[model samples]
Target: QVLCGDDRIDAAVTQVISNLSSPFRSGSLLVNKIEAFEGKELKNVADLSAVVVIKSLADTTVRTVRSSRGQSGAEPVAKLVVPALAPTPNYDAALKQLIKVCQEVHVPLISLPGFGDLAQIADEVRFTFLRQLKLNSTRLHTFLMNLVVEEGLEGLVEEVSNQLNRPVSIESAQFSLMASKNMGGTPASQQRSLVDDVHKSVRKQLKVADSNDGKDWIIPTLKVGKRLVAPIMLGENIVGYISSMVRPNDDMEAIAELLRPAALAAMIEFHQNRQTGPMFAATQKSLLRDLLLGGTLAASDQERMEQHYGFDMADGILVFAASALNAQGQPLALDGLPDSFGVMTEIEGTATVVVPYLANSGKTWQQVAEALQKQLKELVKQKPGGADAQIQIGAGRMSETTFDLAESYREARQALIVGSMMHTNKEFTIGYGELGVKRLLYLMIDHPELERFCEEIIEPLESYDEEWESELVPSLRVYLAEGANLNSAARALFIHRHTLRYRLEQIAEILKVDIDSQEVLLNLQIAFQIRDMMSGSTGKRG
Candidate 1:
């Protein structure tokens, strides 16, 4: 049923097959004609990527080509060709016009010889086309597999580009550029680097490829200006993407065919790497703990740590202490932190995270903190009782060396303590700079003298409030927080200024301390801070 040539013998055989077909027995050997075009003649028979049959005559057309571009506009990567027994009107003139157009576009010429009805054998013809497509797909798989074994991903991608005759790029799950094959000595037209573009695209889209559509891993081709992008998927998840400059009037079917093997290669690589991810992460965590504790490491050990964990002693790093409590008010595990960035470890029940500063990212620490907070917020939403989750993050000052990482960790812990008093809001990041006088007071909170002084200064006031369980302590806190501005304190407490004044006088009378003296006020403030620390309310005093 397949038309191999226009020879008489072949034509006779095609007619014979058409006559014997089931549709012929049903009263007609001629069903419907098919016409297909890419926009021009196919440069090679190998350019055929797939074969699709239009079973319903109503669906038949001269050509069906994808109009949209990029990952969002997914189309078959093949030349659409329809076979017919007879030509339409002006067939000769149309063929000539097609040949002229094919010179400038990818449209294949539509030409057919008038003969006996061939539509009755449409099923056989479509089946043969599919068989050919399968054979070609096998060859593509073989080539990609061989290339991967011989030259790895970079060379494999280059070969794919050569085969598809288009540019191809491979990116990691993080959207970082891994390898790319440039087309015809022309650079990608985007002003930004492809890596930057991919990052921006992923951030904006959240996913570069989506499989929720319940089809193949290929994301619909997304066109950015004159470029095309497709995602490489592992099962249902996207592992990376491939992008290229658009070729004018190019049939994307062939390009999509090439990406199938590329995606397979990417999936293989991703799982292979993931197999060792946990072991590698454990080793990295151990090394980080040792480094932060100032444990001596040999030069080889240091080199190994750097090579495997991507930690460089020369680079600046920051430590973050995230103290999380469950709804039960117990310390949560360090596993609560996101795995996207940083090395997190539990130190005495507190989650300590360390991340190297990305000097090239053009982001400040505050910006990084904001991003982490956002990620954590999203993470919490996925957990049970997330609405009740309480997470407080404290960031240390930037450390220039591993030796200073311990210092940063220590400062971060203290910041968490001091931050609780300075900022009452939970589930946020507070840096060491936000710690003022509490910097020194925080370090001394565990001192017996400090605890004793706090007891002496604030115990009477606290005991008095306990007798009535009143708002005296809250009034004092707000009054101090307002820098002695009575109106501000009264407004904040939702009480009249006279009521606040009366409370202050009563507090002074019971404590037998001067309410107006700056010296007494400072002492009382220090005592209250110490008491909070001792009660395990402000931070981990022990």
Candidate 2:
């Protein structure tokens, strides 16, 4: 099935391989043919180097020269030459032949590279190529929103740095409209300082050398800081900067290119974070105020807000009132108080106590007052000794409504004011029954004219005749006026029963009336009521 030919066939086969392997060129391969022979026609033709005269029956063009190896006397063999055969084949055999040819030619052949294999060597490199194109298109969208929801900007930076195996420092984080000027102008200087440091560090760490032909390339080293600063550009403007300090095994220019996309993502995220700061602060304030007022939002509502807006609801509440000391050590402005507590707007010139209506741990209004009093007492103790410091506290009333709060505030303030007048330097006071009335009475007692009126009413008794002043007159007045109860009269006057009886005898000697008589008791009772009424009415008019 096979035919042997002249050595010209070997020369033609070699030319075909050379033409296929060489880049595009002219006159590289030429086909040749020879007549079939029954046996080997050319002896020792392997070592012969000479042009063969090829003759062909077909009309293919051929150029030939006389054979130099044969004697001039011998007849030359005719040779036929034609165009070289094409080198097309099946995929499997082609690959095998290509490999074999490469081995024979001492050349290396490689198939197209895959992503998975490249990723194992350098994942950052792979991610960079993938995310850069996609992330650049999304620069207009605020990325900070994602950062805030996932974690804060700082946390995001830390995480990204960790994932990339780099040490990162975020600088000049700001948020505004895309077209806005540098909003952080004053702080830009500080940012520049950090940038400069990063630049110096990076330049020192990166070792670059020039080849003999003056081509620049980098060498690997780990002795110095490798710093990288990336500008986060949104559209035509730069929005922020990300600085990284790292030591990499390879050239960092490639690494910097890889980090650019992630930096852009982080910048977008930081911008969104800045936009929500005020909203977060406002939400926090509202929640704290609500809890202090004892209003409860639904758990679901809270969850929704916290999820959407990232508000925290775990803060504690406190309320306080300010009381300034007067010359006589009495607390002032203690009347006609408002129900709901207001935040202490100012307290530097005077002292204020912020009373929280609602707090954690089920503390009643009374307990709140007690705690405030304790705090105030501590403050007083810290003041200079012998300074005549005076403070009074009233019990707090618990209620959820702001309307009810005023009454409690008023009662507590009034009680404190009254206690200040009654007892000097009292730490705290609670209003109960008669004490509550006394507290109200002292509100009127502040006027000196009222005190004069009260004194005028009692003045007549001080100047009564000697017989009236004698123990008998006072004993009869107290006994008969006090419902003829001997023990009550004796107890009211701080006297023994026998001593009270003796005093009654003396009263009989002076007034000549039986102390037990109903008529006398009625008259005495009327006289005492008249005296009290006169004093009270005069004081009021004064």
Candidate 3:
């Protein structure tokens, strides 16, 4: 409609496409390099460079249009073209035809200064197509709206990234990274580093939650490093979050505006899919603490959580605790190894993992530990500056329900503490059952009944040994510890079997109980443990 052809660079590509007759004009230009066709059988039509030459319709003959208004008909063969766009040709079939048709004939496509120079075309194509588009408000809205028709949150996130020419990420309300789109060409490691920084920023904000007494005090938009973040809030609650990299074309202001509607669209999307509650977790930590501390959930919270995390408390469960040591042998917070294995949380300074157990299906704790160690090794390799870090894991006994998991959680943490004390400078997986007498010592060390029972059982033997100057107590201990084996106890005592038998009989007479009875032997075995603990001896390590 302009009196003269508007020669602005923005309209140059359009003007060149417009010069062709109607059908051909609609086709998109394929400015890809020619060398990209290396593997394919190409019709040696033109010696185009390393990139694609022309992607327009036909090859040799083109019906140029001098007729948009009053004129009509072709004006001598000129511009190149591609498969028609109206009906939208099957891409695969259309590409095959284009390759086949190029067997002969060469036609010059539309050319304009600064836009069509041989050197600038490939750069232009890459700059325009490979990068995120600098979209205006209307175009951005249209782009995001169009993507909503596609299924999944991934499509929406990906398209916003594609058109916006930036890194766009979607995270569950708990700030767990969910989906990401990056067109700015950042390396994966750097991206992960950036994500970590963003997570810290968000968590730093969440720390404010505790002080605010759960009131909605989270900042709506958080700018951390080079990323701009916004919550996808549904009134007072947040369902998820959107984050984008800050840049000239897509700065904080633009990203903030984009996230506003994106949040609504995301909420609508989740709503249409009939999801329940916040998308992931606004109370992720609270839920974690309550369950792990005691596995207690209010009926309403439990029902909603059941629908949210889709887990059943009736399932058998095992709890694990993990700690990492840096190269300097200092403790580092565990790096999501527990998380990769199962539902994970941080309690105190240790990483706690609650893995659903399937005992009815013949699953055992050994199998779980083995699988977990294997996964942990793989995940450790991904942590930065942690190549030399050591991971020490401890697991608790298999539990029958989420309620029982509380004990397992405590045991898991205890195992890590006790395992580190017992197995210094080595990696270990110490189950609660593995601690043996040491566990008993730890639990009953301060119990008044423990000391009373130990005194009652052992005082007679001690008095008898002191009076007669006999080794009855040592011999008795060896006998019970050797599981009442005559020869084993004799060898342990370094005495003849008859000598040990005589001493044991004397010990039985002194204590006024048959040493060979199962109940008597059990008490004596526990008595020896008390003796060791009283004598300041932790149980021996193998």
User: Candidate 3: lDDT of 116?
Assistant: 32
Model 2 agreement with the true structure over 1-542: per-residue lDDT tens digits: 11122223233111111112224222112111222111222222232222121222222346565565576677776665554533422244434443344344333333322222332323443345347545643652244335535765565565556645666554442312221111122233244343334334333333333233433422221222355556543221233455556565443544464355556666555445433664333333333333333334456534543443222332322333435344465543322122243232211122223344435647755566565555454444544441344446544344343334335445545554455444444444454222533653555565566446434432333344343544544555577647788999899889999999876665544445675677755554544433333343211111
TM-score of 2: 0.28
Model 1 bad stretches (over 4 Å): 1-285, 299-315, 336-340, 359-366, 377-387, 416-428, 433-448, 463-471, 537-542
Q: For all candidates, what are the clash counts?
A: 20, 22, 13
TM-score of predicted structure 3: 0.38
- Give the poorly placed runs of model 3, Cα more than 4 Å off: 1-286, 295-315, 322-332, 338-340, 359-362, 373-404, 410-444, 448-478, 488-496, 502-514, 517-520, 531-542
Better of 2 and 3 by lDDT: 3
Backbone clashes in model 1: 20
Q: Estimate each model's TM-score.
A: 0.42, 0.28, 0.38
Please give the lDDT score at residue 21 for candidate 2.
Answer: 27
For 1-542, candidate 1 gives per-residue lDDT tens digits of 32222232111111111221232211111212334322234333212211121222222346656445557767746456784433333333433443454344332222333244446445666566467667876887877777776677788778777777777777654335667887322133341243344334433343433434533323344555555666554333344666666676665544655675666765555545543664334444554655665444556655765655456733578788876556665544446455557766655445678777868888788887777666555666556655566778889999986768778988888787676654444556788987766687777766788867877887777778888877677788778778878999999989999999999999889889898999988886776666664554542121
| Candidate 1 vs candidate 3, TM-score winner | 1
Q: What's model 3's lDDT at 128? A: 68
Q: Rank the candidates by TM-score, best first.
A: 1, 3, 2
